[model samples]
Target chain A: MNAIIEVQDVSKSYGGVVANKRVSMTVQAGGITGLIGPNGSGKTTLFNSIVGYHPIDSGSIKFEGREISKMPVQSIARLGLIRTFQQTRIYAAMDCTQNMLISLPHRKMKFLDAFSKHGESDHAKAERLLEFVGLYEKRFLNAGSLSFGQQKLLEFAMALMNEPTGLLLDEPTAGINPTLINGLIDRLKRANREFGITLFIIEHNMRVIMNMADKIYCLAHGEMLAQGTPQEIQNDQRVVDAYLGTH
Target chain B: MNTKNIIFYVALLVLTAIAPFLFPDFRTQLATLWLMIVVAMTWDMTGGQMGYNSLGNILFYGTGMYVAAVISIGMVHDVGAYTDAGRLELMTFTERQYFVGAIVGIIGAGLFCSVTAIVVGYVTFGLRGPYFAIGTLGVAIAAGELVSNWGWIGGGQGISLPVYPGNFDVGKLFFYYLFAGTGVVLFMFLKWLYSTRFGAAINAIRDDEEKAEAMGIHTMRYKLTTWAMAAFFVGIVGGISGFQLIHFEPLETAYQTTNLGIFMVVCVLLGGKGTLWGPVIGAILFHFIKEVTWNYFLGWQWVALGALIVVTVVYFQDGVMGWLAHRKPQSPRL
Candidate 1:
């Protein structure tokens, strides 16, 4: 598979403290790639840098073989690289359908198209997405009224509205219940298999990372500790030492 | 629409429209009051809904008033000379000029405000909480000073619009209705926007800008858009206000910078920031209190308003909407 996103020697510092120290990674096209690390392990920092949410101190980022390290967040998004927050970011007052509709690019609608027609299309897309995530029944309900797990699912579905080529999910199942985690995993898998979209996930859940990731990279102290298939990573001495003490 | 809500809006609009007809003497005065409410609602669009806390709204209002005054005055003076016969001068040059200028001015103001917002966003968007508020306040002060010093458009003394030859009362009434109609249309448009996808993005931005950006929202673009919308309406309103008063003085226009802007902010805070009807309700109530209490109590009216603001902030942390929202019980979990 072709490398869709390439990060080369990227470093980021916040004042005196370094968040990402010369981090480099390649995300392949059309598969679920995982980055597993403990808290403050620079996984999120790296994700931010790649998506242009944070400026890099040095090095380059290439998406579709074009440099995007200095590109604005909106332009980068237009290029089909999208991301979701670790925290659920949704319009609390808006219904679930409205939340999904906002992510659809403005270019899709012509100026003469009546707003009601736009609303209809938005409603249809929102319903379809909600159904995919099993939140269809709550489409009309305020997003804020939904449970935390459901909000996470809504965030996922909203991100997919733009039809992104690569998704940067920061802990898709982080705070969700075990029952919903299964559903979250299923939907994510379907997004990859059915939609043929590439994914780069930063997760702390071992089961989730192992079960869903085609390849996994481990990070510790803003540096790569280990990278391989699930079995290889599980048996790696460095990975084991980083997760469980020096024993 | 629900019958009750529809009835409420219809009744409200009818009362407002017929108010002047019933009380012709106070027609112009009443419309001006409602125009102020519209200005307050415009402020709420950015400061309340988007959580931007912009104090530079006066900038747009002032610009609008000047633009409208300049166009109307320029038109009447230039065209009045040619119309010997009372045939309602066919699109006088000044009228045409004024229209072009007003459109250009509105667009220019929108662009200017958007750019200002973009710069402010880049600088302060990273700063969360109180720092963000301070940053916006600083921008307002700086922009206000810059505009005030620019001497071309009456600088500090201000410009006087050309007095039309028609009956002053009728002319004033016409201006009043024009502003009143504009306010109603603007209010409706904003209400519609509040229910759309753009509104969702704005709400998300308010809740958490960083989170919204992470959700691939292009938060900066949304901020700029809100700023432009606010500027466009405020500028047009400002222009009409100047034309009504027949003065385009910066200090008079900029008078809005201090008193009216703060008043609107207070209105939004007291009523509720993000709710659609909150600012309008707040503006009307605040205006009524000012008119009634000040008329009666003289000198101490401001004190009452201050006290009310303090009490509302303390008790109704979410403002009136929160209080009302809390009164409704939540549905029991199944």
Candidate 2:
């Protein structure tokens, strides 16, 4: 399959601390890719770099073969490369429907268009996405009032509102209950299948990532430790050691 | 559009139209109330709605006052000569010039402040939270100091424009209508603005800037635009105040950071920050309190005002609307 996102030799650091070093990976279009790393292993940093959240120290990031490392976060997002936070970041003061509506790309609209009401199709799509994420009932409530898992679901719906080609989820099910985790995983997979959206997920839960990702890349100490099917990476000594070493 | 809503708005409109005539003795005080409302509501645009609590919005008010005065004077006479303290002869504006100057000057003030907001926001928006607040405050303070030193525009002595070319009471009515007209338009504009997608975008920026940006919002553009719009209204009101006062100095009357500047923030806090009606309600309540304390508690007015602020901050941080919302959960949020 052709790659939707390509990151080559991407390095990022904070002051004297190096978070990611010569990190390289690619996410295939219409596929679920897993990134498994121990805490502080540069998974989030790499996600930030790919989505233009911060400037990378060195390296190249390509979305659909177009250079986007130098672009602003909003411009890169308009190109359909969007990232969610490790801690779900919904517009807390706004209701879930508002959160969804505001997530529509403002790239093509003129400044004056901002004052226009959300169109019928936009509202319909927002409702559909909310239903998809099982947040239809909570759509009218302020997002801040929702529980953490529900907020995550709302955030997921919001991300879907943009119709991103590639979605970078930072631990989508980290704080979610086990019962909800199963539902979230199912929805995520369905999004990939039905919408043909590529997903590059950073997950700490081994069983979940192993079950979801067709191919998994494991990182340790800011470097790629292994790249293989979940079955193969599960047996890799370095990947195993990285988790054990961190613990 | 229900009967109740329609009647309420009609009555409010009638009240606004007759307020100056009804309270002829307190026309000036009523005009100042509109001033407070305009500033507070505009302040809420950036401070409450967008979560960019700026302590320096008075910069626009001061700038608008100067721009309006200069434009008004420059139309009929040399502004520099008119403002020159040593000038021997009095410069006068005919009735046509007076009305024309005021209209053009007020509109010019609004436009000029909009541009200033974008320029100043470019530098200040880079600083977040308290740093942004402090940086803007510095800009206003520096402007005041600079204008005070610059003799071209009256220096620290300030500028005085020709009085309204008509009967005195008529002039009061003229300024009162100007202020009331602006306040009503601003209130209506904000009512519509808060219901738009732009409103959602700004609320998103307020909720979380990073997430808003990551979600494909041009957060900086929204921020700049919101501030510029707010400054435009504030500038217009400031122009009206400049004309009403007939004389204004750079630091005290025009800039007035310690007074009107801080009052706007307190007004927003007293009213509810993000809610549309909160600032307007808060301004009225604060103005009433200020007048009461100044009149009745003369010796302890400052102390009493401080106490009121302390109580508002500590006990009622949500302001009147928020308190009401808490009391009645069914109350609709603006």
Candidate 3:
């Protein structure tokens, strides 16, 4: 598979706490790659470093064969590498459609467009994305009113609206309802399959990660522990000992 | 536009059009009303929309005031002599000179403030939340002091503007209408802006700035744009007020940080910060309350202000607009 994102020996730390120690990983184009680790294994830190939320201390990251380790979040996002937060951060005061509208990162942001109604295509696309997330009826309602599960779905829809080439989602199913988890998994798969987008997901849920990802990498104590296909990682003795936290 | 909005705006236009003739006595008050609205609206741009509460907008106002006074007085009269004979108030200008000078001053003030906004925005927008507010407040005080010590613009004593060339009431009406026209334009423009991607982008910054940046918005650009827009309107309004007042005092009248500075912020909050109509309603209500209390209570006006602010802030914290937006009308059947 052609690699879309390449991280080579990246190291990041916060004042005596090494979060990601010489961590290197690759995400292939049009594929769902998963990162799983035990608590405080630097999973979120690695996600932040990859998506340019913060700078790494050492090493390089490449997006679609272009260097992006030094780029800011918005710059990376403009290049179609978007990431969603672990806690959903929808523009709460705005309605779902407005939230979707703002998520669009197209370059044509004229001031006069504020007065004009959203273009038919923009509205149609926003509506279609909302429906994809099962939020069609709540399109007009304020995002703050949505439940935690629903907010995550809105966030997912928001990311999709950007039409990104690569998406880095941090903990997409954490704190979501068990029932909604399946729906999220299906949407994630469809986004990858139908949209032809690459996904690098950091998940704590083993079942979801095992079910969705084509390949899995595990981290422990701020270091890579193992990487393999679902069945291989599930059966690996070290993975079971460190990450599963049980015999 | 929808029929409801169109009808509402037309009705508003009608009320404003007939206002000066209907109450000729209140033309001066009406002019003040328009100026107050501009202040509230500009303040709202920073305080409500961009989530950057600025205490130093008065710096632009004060600068524009002095700039207009200097330009108007310098025209058709010697600048040095005018400052020297300030106690006599003897300088004068031809009608054409005054109009030309005032027009130039107004446009110049807006341009000057917007340029200043770029410099100040770069410095202040870097600071977040309360630090930004305090930094701007410091800059504003320093600006007032700088002008206070500057001899060219008439140091501590202050400069005098030329007397109106024609009838006093007509002059008052002229300013009243000038202010009214710009107020309407500013209001409608903001109303227009509040609907666009520009509006959404700024609102996104206010809601979650980090997330807004991650969403591919250059947050600083929008923040600075909002600040510059506020500066443009406030600057013009200040220049107009300088001409209308016929006097320019440095600390008291021009900068007056303790008085008019705080009043603008209070007015925006009193109406609603982010919403378009909030500033208009807030300014109107605040001006009337101030006029009534100052007219009747004399030295006790502060007492009235304190009491009213407590009631409004405690009970109507969302301001009048937020309160109005929240209330649903009763069904006719019910």
Best candidate, TM-score: 2
What ranges in model 1 sit over 4 Å off? A13-19, A105-117, B2-11, B72-152, B247-249, B317-322, B328-334
lDDT of 2 by residue, B35-124 (tens): 999999999999899999899999999999999989988988987888888999968889999989999999999999999999999999
| Rank by TM-score (best first) | 2, 3, 1
* Model 3 lDDT tens row, A98-118: 999988765445544544656
Write model 3 residue lDDT over B240-325, tens digit each, in one string: 98889887778998888877888888788899879888888899999999999999999999999888778776887788777766
> What's the C-alpha lDDT at position B134 in model 2?
95
Query: DockQ-based ranking, best first?
Result: 2, 3, 1
| Residue B27, model 1: Cα distance from true site in angstroms | 2.4
Q: State the DockQ of every prediction.
A: 0.29, 0.83, 0.62
> What's chain A's TM-score in each predicted model?
0.94, 0.96, 0.95
Q: Where in model 3 is the C-alpha error above 4 Å?
A: A108-116, A244-247, B2-4, B73-91, B329-334
Ranking by lDDT: 2, 3, 1
* C-alpha lDDT of residue B247 in model 2: 92
- Give the Cα-based TM-score of candidate 2 against the true structure: 0.97
Interface RMSD of each: 3.7, 1.1, 2.1
Predictions in order: lDDT: 0.74, 0.91, 0.87
Clashing pairs in 3: A114-B195, A114-B196
CA RMSD of all predictions: 5.6, 1.6, 2.8
